[model samples]
Target: MTEPLGAYGSVVEMLEAAATRAPDHPALVCEQVELTYARYRDCVAALAADLARDGIGAGDRVGLLMGNSAQIAVATFGVQAAGAQVVPLNPAYTESELGPVLKDADLALLIHDAGLEELAGAAAPKGTRCLIVGPGARDLTQPTGAPPAPLSLPDPQTLSTLQYTGGTTGAAKGVDLRHAAVAVNVAQREALLPTGPDERVLAITPLFHVYAVAMGLYLAANCGGTLHIVPKFTAAAVLRDIERHRITFLSASPTIFQALLRDPAFAETDLSSLRVCSSGSSALSAEVLHRWEEATGCAICEGYGQTEAGPVLTYNALHGPRRAGTVGVPVPATEIEIVDTDTGLVPLAPGAAGEIRARGPQLMAGYRNRPEETAATLRDGWLYTGDIGRMDDAGHLVICDRKKDMVVTAGYNVFPREIEEVLFAMPGVADAAVVGVADDYRGEMLCAFVVGAEGDLPEERIRAHLAERLAKYKWPRDIRCLAALPKTAVGKTDKKELRQVASVPPSEPA
Candidate 1:
C-alpha cells in the first residue's frame, strides 16, 4: 500500500519490513498450514544463511522449479536475500522444454520441489548443486548456536530475476530485470488494485508467472495481507478454499475462469466474499465475462503486460470505468505510445493501430546474452512491445494483435484477435484461437481452431457467424474443431503450435 520505494529500496528490504511491521499476522497459507510473518521471516533467514554457506552469492543465477506453495515463497525471498538472481522454471515443463533454459542460463544452483527432483536433476548442468524441498526431501540445515548470517542486500541496479518470455511467438528469451524495477512493478499493481490488510488473496495460477507473483503473492505480502497458495489449480478445490478462507481477491487466466464457470458447484458456491477478479494471459470471451459477472457479482478486470516490462504495464480501473475489450490506462509512473512499426519514431494518432512502445521504472534492462535482440527491443529508454494496439480517446488501449501474428493475405492485413473475438461472441463457442497459415497463392491464409461447449461445432455455423461480422478476406479458410486449444506454460494460447498444425495437410488432426 505504500508508495513504490525509491532507488535505495530492494524487494528484500521491503519484505523484511513487512515481516518486522506485522510479525504476528498470517503471511502465507497452503492447505491446512499457515505461517505467521515472524515464522516466514525466520525460515527465509535460515535458508538465506544456508544458501550463502553453499557459496550462492551476488550475481549468481539460481533456478527454482517448484509448484505454487509456501515453499516457493520461502525459496524466492531466501534466494534473493542471499543476493542471487532467481530463474523460475515451470513445474510442469518436460525435460525437453526445461533443458535448453537450464543450459542457456548456466545456473549456479537448482532448487526444486521433492515431487520434481528427478526432472530438475535431469535439467541441471552437471556441476550445479541441487536443493530439494517438501516432505522427504533433502534437509536445508543451518547451525543452531550462531546467529543467522546477515543478508547481502542488492542495490537498485542489481539483477533480481531472469524472467523468460512466454514462447507463444518464437523461442523464449531471458529478460534481465533489476530489483528496483521489480519492486516498482509490484507497487504499480498494488496502486491499481488495492487490497486491504485483512484481505485474503487466492493465488491459483503458477507462482512462477510474473502476473501471479505480482498480483497475488507480492501484493499480499506488501499490503500485510494473507496469501492462500494453491499448489495447482482445481476448480472444486479453489471454490472450497474461497468459501473456507473468505478469499477477497483472485487472479487467474481466462481458461481457468472458464473452467470454474463450468464446474458443477459454481452456482451454489459462496463467492460473496470475493471483491475482485483479474483476468489475463489471454482474451476473456464476452460470454464467459457476462456469465461470471452475473453469477458472482464481481467484475473481471483485464490487464496487459509482457516479460520485458517487469510483466505489468496497465490494468482496468478499479474505481472508475472498466472496459470489456480494452486493457485500461497505463499504471502510475509509466508511459505508453503507439508508433510506426518500421520507423519506431512516428507516433500514431488516436485510435490508429500500431506497435505499442512503453517506458517505465519497471522496464527490464535487456535480454540476457542476446545483445542484438536486446538492441532491437530496447530503443533509447523505451521498450518496443511487439504487440499491436490502438488507444481510444479515453486513454484505454485495445490490443489488435501481435505484429508477428498478423496475417497478410491478398494485400490485406488481418489480425487474429479480431476474428477470434467474433468467434468468442458466438453462442456455442467455448474457446477459439486464430493463426495464419502459409498459402500457395495468397501468401497466407486464416485458420480458426475452436472448442465448442458440447459436441463438435459445425464448420458452416462458424463460417456463417464470421461472414456476418467480418469481411470475406478476414474469414477463416480452414476450421479445426478440438476438445481444447493448446496453451503455453503461462496459460496463453500456443499460437506457435497452432501454426505448425496449420502447416500440415488437412487430413492430419491438430
Candidate 2:
C-alpha cells in the first residue's frame, strides 16, 4: 500500500523519500543523459547548498527562467530544498516582457539558462543577482561547494511556488501554492492516471507552467518513474523520441496532439508501449481526439483545471468509460459544482451552464500580494474558477468557454469556443480563434482568425458551414486566414492578441 504523503511537510521531503526508496532508479532522462535517483538527489543537495550560501531561505523568492530541460527539474528541487519559493519565468520573454515579472516578484536571485544571460541581465531589477544554469557559467546545475547538510523540513503551509496564472485575460497574477497543496495536487493527478515505479513518462510541455509541474515532474518523481524531458516541442522530434524511448505515458496539450497527427511519421511510428495520453491547457477538439485514438489505439484523456486549482480538477478515467470532449469526473478527494454565475451561491441543476467552482486540498493558498483578487477568487474554501462550463446528465464536465471569452453581441451571449469547435471540425482549418470586435450595427461583431493546414479555405464555404448550424447572431462577421494563430507563452491560442488584430480594418484588395 502507498503510505499517506500528507505527513511530509514539504515537497523536498517527499522527493527525498522517493530518492531514498529508489536510489538506483532513473529519475530523469534528457536525450542521452540519464540521472539516477541517487545522483539527482546529490545534485539537488549541492545546489541547495549553493543557494543557502547565497542567503535564499524560507519565503525568499528564487526566480527560474529557462525552457524545459534536466536543469529545470534539478533547479526546481534544489530551490525548494533550500526552503525558498520558486518563481518560474518564461525564457521566451524578451526584456520588456520579463521585466514586470522580475520587478513584481522582487526576487533575491534570478536563476536563468546560460543562453539567456543577456536577456536576464536586461530584465532583472537593479541589485537582483543572476545565477546561470545549463552547460556553461554556472550555479545550481554545477556546484563548486560541498554538499549542504540536510535542512529541517518546512511547515506544511510554507509557500512552495508562486506560479503566475496565464495572462489570457490580463496581467498575470502570482498564485501562492503551499507545500501541502502541491503535494495534494500531485497525488490527485496520480489517482486519476495511476502509474507504477517502472513507468516511463515523456513530457513535452513546458515545466514553467503549473500543469506540467504537477502532472509531469512531481507525478513522475512521486512514483519514482523515469521521465524523458524534451527541452522544446517539435512534432517530428517528439514522435521520434516517443518511439525511441518506448514511453508508456504522455502529458501534453491538444495543440501538440494535433501537430503529431499532422506529422507523416506519426502514422508509421510504433506506439504499442503507450498506456495513456493526457491532454490539457486547451480544449481538445473532437476531430483531433478521434484521429489520435484511431491512429495510436490509446485514449487521449482530456482534463480541466487552472493554475490556482492545483492545476487539475477533473480527468477522464484510465480504466472506466473515457469521453472525448468532456474533461470527465473530478479526481478523488475533490468536489466540483456548477454554480449560477450571477450569485455564485446556488448550485445549478445538471446540464445547466454556470461558473465552475472547485474545492480540494490541492487548491492554492491565494493570489500573492493581491488580497482583493484573492478574496474574489477563493471564497469560503471554494476556488471560483472563472471558466464557464456545464455538467452533462452523466456527470461529466464540459468546458464551454472562459467567462471573459464570451462575446456579448446584440442581446445574445456567443461563446467563442462554440464557434472555434465548429471551425476545428471543418476540413483544412488547422487552428481557429474567435473574438468580439467593435461595431455599431450589433454592439459587437464576432470575428474569426484561422490557420489552414493545406491552404486558404474558401470564405464562402466557412460561412455556409456556420450558417447551417448557428443562429445569425452567433455567426462570425469576418474570417481572416493566417499561417498560424498567435500563441501565449504556455501555448494556448492567444485570443487576447487576436482581438487586437480583429480591431484593425482590412485594406482594399490590391
Candidate 3:
C-alpha cells in the first residue's frame, strides 16, 4: 500500500519547515535578484501581518495578477499565511477577460504589477482594493519594517487557493483547493519523481499556472531546494539558464521542448546537470520525445492531470521502468479507473477506451459557488475527468482525447489527437491541431491546421501524408497552414480559436 509522503498540515507549513531546516540556503533566483530561505520566510511573515492589519483574513479572496517574478511567489504564500485564499490570475488577460472573473471572485484585494494598475482599476468592481508591486511600486519581497508575526496556520480542510481554469471551451470556473489537498499533491508528485535539497529547478512557465505551482514552486519548497524563475520564455534564455545555474530539474510543455530543439544554441548548451525533466499541460509527441532524449541523453517524463485534480494525477516513475507513450501509473495514494462516458459508473477493463475518473487526496473541494457544476463533475467521491483515455495491462494510462473535442463525421466518431500525432511526425511540420466544424451533410467535419517548419507547407503534401496513415473517414476535409498555432495562457494549443478560423468559408480547401 502507498502511504502519504509527509505530515504537513498546510503548504505554508511546508515553506516554514524548509526555512527552519536551511535558513541560509538559496530559496529563489530571478535575474539579478536572489533570496535566502530565512529572508524569504521573513518577507512572507511580514506580508501576512500587514494584510491582517488591513482586515484581510479567512474567507477573503485576494487576487494576484502579475507575470512571473519573485514577488509573486512571496504574495502567493503570504496571502494564504494570513488565512485568506489566493486567486492567481494571468497578467496577460485583457480588461474584458479580467472583468467577469474579478466580478465573480468578489475579491477583497487585488495585488498586481505596476503597469496593470489601469486595467485592474477598470476591470475590478468598485470597493475592491488594489496593491501594486514591481517597478515604481512597493516591493512585496521586502520586509515592511515590521517584526514578523506568528503565522495564522490553517487546518487540513481550510480553503487556500482559488485557481481559475483557462476557459478554452467557455467561461473560466474557479477550482477550490484546500490547504491539505495542495500540500499533499506536492508530496504525491515527490513520491513519483523525487527531488532533493541539492536540486536546482528552473521554472520557465507562468507562476499562476497550477502546473508551475505544484511541480515548480511547491516542489522546490518541499525539498528545501533553489528555484530559478524566468519572467518569460525565450529559447536562448532558457538554454543559458540551465547551463549557468546547473539546473537539475526542468518541468515544461512540449511546445517549449520543441522550441528549444529548433534553437541553434540548444546543441552547444551544456545540459549535463539535468537529472529529471517533466512534460505536462498537453500531450507530448513521440517524435519530439525521441529527438529531445537523443540530444540531451535525458528522458522526458510526461504526466496527465487537470486543474480540478490539484493539477497532477499521474507521472512517469523516476526509479522504475519508464514508458514512452503513456502518462504512467497513478501517483501515490491515487486511484484511477476508466469509466463509461454515458453514465460514468461502470468501470471498463484494461485497453477499453472511456472517460478517466480519479479519486484521491489531491482532488479539489469543488468549483467555487458552482454547486451544479460541482455535482455534475464529482459523483460518488470520484472526479469524472472529462478526459478520454485507456489503461494498458501494466497500469500505464494512455490519454486519447478530451470528451468535448471528439468529432463525429458521417456516422463515425473521430479523435483529433490521433491525427494530430501523425501530423507531428511528418517532415517539415512544426505544429498541428485538429478541430471539428459544422457541416451540412456530415453533421460535423474535421479541419486541420498545420504550422510549417520553415515556410508555407504545400496543402497537397499534408493531404498525401494523412491519406497514407489514416482511414478515409478520419481525413480532414479542409487543411490550413499557419506560421504558428495560437496558444492559451498555460501554453496549450488554442483549439477554440482554430475552430473559429475553420468556420469561415474559404475559396478552396487548402
Candidate 4:
C-alpha cells in the first residue's frame, strides 16, 4: 500500500495540466460535441468565478441536478475550484425526495439541465444562487467570460461533496466526503489502474451516482485523463461510441455488460482499446463476467464502494491478484472487516460470512443533519456497510446477502428486487413473492407470486430453473402470477406495491 499523500496538492493542478499539455485533446464527449481539456479547464475556471460572483463560496453547498454531460463535469470541477461543496442530486428523484435533501444540505447554488428544469427550479432554495446547464445553458464546450478570481482551497480535510446514498433502510442521507478523502480515493485509483495522460475515459454512468462522482469525474480529473461522458447507457450506442473515440477506460454496471454481451455486434466492436472495464452499483454475476470476457476479450474487474466512504472501498487492480466473485481485497489505504451478521463481532475463522465494515481516510466525516442515524451507522469510526460477505484466506471478499429485508433476484437486489429470486424455485410454483402479508404461517410465509411466460419461459419451467439453483428453505411455498410486476426508477421490481395486490385471492379460469 502506498503512503497516502499527506502534503495536499491542489486539484486544479489536474485541470491546469490538461489545459497545458493536451489543449486540443477531447476531454469530454456527449452526443456530437467534444470538449478539449484547455477549454474544459477555462470553462471550469469561468464557472467557478461565476459561482463566486453569485455569493457561493468555499463551505457553501452547490447542488447539481442533471444527467451526464460535459456541462455536469465542468460544473463539478467549477464547484470544487470555486471552493464550494458540490451536492450531486439524481434528476429522477421525486419532489418529495428532493425537497428535504436540499433543505438539509443548505444549498445556496444550483445548476440544472432542461429535462429537470421544472422539478429543480421549483426545488431551488429561495434566494439560492443558481446556474443552469442545458441545451442552450452555458455553451460549456466553449469557455465563457474572463478568468474568475481563483478561490483558495482550505485544508485537504475540508468538505468537498455531500453525495446522496441509496437509503434502502431509511430516508436518503447526505454523505460528507472531504477533499482529503476524495483525493486519497483518486490517488489510489490512479495507482491501481495507472492510466497515462493521453488515455480517454468513456463515462456512461450517471454523474449523480457517487461512484461516478468520485471515480469517474474526480479520478479522471486528478489524472488529467480525457473524459467521454455519455448521458445514459445503451448497448448499441455505447458500442458505436467506444469505437468512435477509441475509448480506453469504462466505468459502468453489470446490466450494461449483459446487454452488450447479448448483442450480436458486440464481437465486431473494437473493444480491444478498452484496457480497464470496471463494474459496481450491483454484483457482476460470474456468469455475466464469463460471457463479457468471452465477448470483449476484456475481463470485468469488480470495484466495491458506497456513498459513505467517499464511494470507493476496494477495486480489483488492473494488474494484481484480481478475484472474480469477491469485490477484491481492500484498496491500498483501506481496512475492511467481515464479521458475524447478528453477533456484531469479527469471527476468528477466515471463511466466515458476515456484515462488511470498514474505516479509512476515505471514510465520510458523517451524514448531514441526522445525528442518531449517523451514530447508529458510523460505529467506532467504522462505517458498517449493510452488505453481507465472506473473506477468503487470500483476504478477498465475496458478497452473500443484504442485512436489510431485501431480495437479490438475479443480481438486481430486489430491495423490494422482489420475492422472485427466493420464490421462483419452489416446488409447484407458478410464481411467488416470499413476501410478508399478515401471514398466519411462520409469521411471514414464503409466498410466490409467479406467472408463466407464454411461449417458452413458463412459470413451472422457471420454477424448475430456480429449484436446481436455490436452497429448498429459501424457496417460495405459495405461488401466483399477475399480468406484470411493479417497478421503480431503473426498473427493479416493486415488491411493496405487489404486497397490496397479493391481498386479493388468485383468480381461477372457468
List lDDT for all candidates, in order. Answer: 0.81, 0.81, 0.86, 0.70
Positional deviation of residue 181's Cα in model 1 after best superposition, in angstroms: 0.1
Full candidate order by lDDT, most accurate first: 3, 1, 2, 4
Best by lDDT: 3
Predicted structure 2, TM vs. truth = 0.80
Query: TM-score: which is higher, 3 or 4?
Result: 3
> Over the stretch 189-297, how does candidate 2's per-residue lDDT look in tens digits?
7777788788889988889977788778887878888989998889899998889988999888766787788888887888888989988776677877898888888
RMSD of candidate 1 to the truth, in angstroms, is 10.7
Clash pairs (backbone) in predicted model 1: none
Give the true-structure RMSD of model 3. 10.5
Q: Which candidate is the best by TM-score?
A: 3
Tens-digit per-residue lDDT, 1-510, candidate 3: 022575787889988988888999999999877999998899999989889999999999999998999999999999999999999997866565578789989998999999988889988999889999998888977787866965668777899999987433446689999999898888888888988889999998889988888888888888899999999889899999999999999988777888899999999999999998998866677888899999898879989888899978998998887888899999988999999999998999999999999999989999988898899899989998888999998999998867766665643446787688779989999999999986644557899999999987999999998876665767899998888999999999998888888999777463
How well does candidate 1 match the true structure in TM-score terms? 0.79
TM-score for candidate 4, residues paired by index: 0.79
What lDDT, from 0 to 1, does candidate 4 have? Answer: 0.70
Clashing pairs in 2: none
Over 1-510, each residue of candidate 1 has an lDDT whose tens digit, in order, gives 465444225677767777778889998899766788777777778878778888887879998898888888888888888888999887766565577788888888899988886777776778778888888874332224455644557777889999876333335578898988988888887677776778899998888877788788777877778999998778899999899999999888776787788899898899999999988765566677888999999988888988799888999978889888898889889999999988989999999999999999999999888898889899999999888999999999998877756665543446787678788999999999999976644556889999999978999999998886664767889999989988999999999999998888779764
**Regions of candidate 1 where Cα sits further than 4 Å from its true position:** 4-8, 139-152, 166-169, 405-510
Lowest lDDT 10-residue stretch of candidate 3: 404-413
Task: For model 4, state the Cα shift of residue 129 in Å.
Answer: 4.4
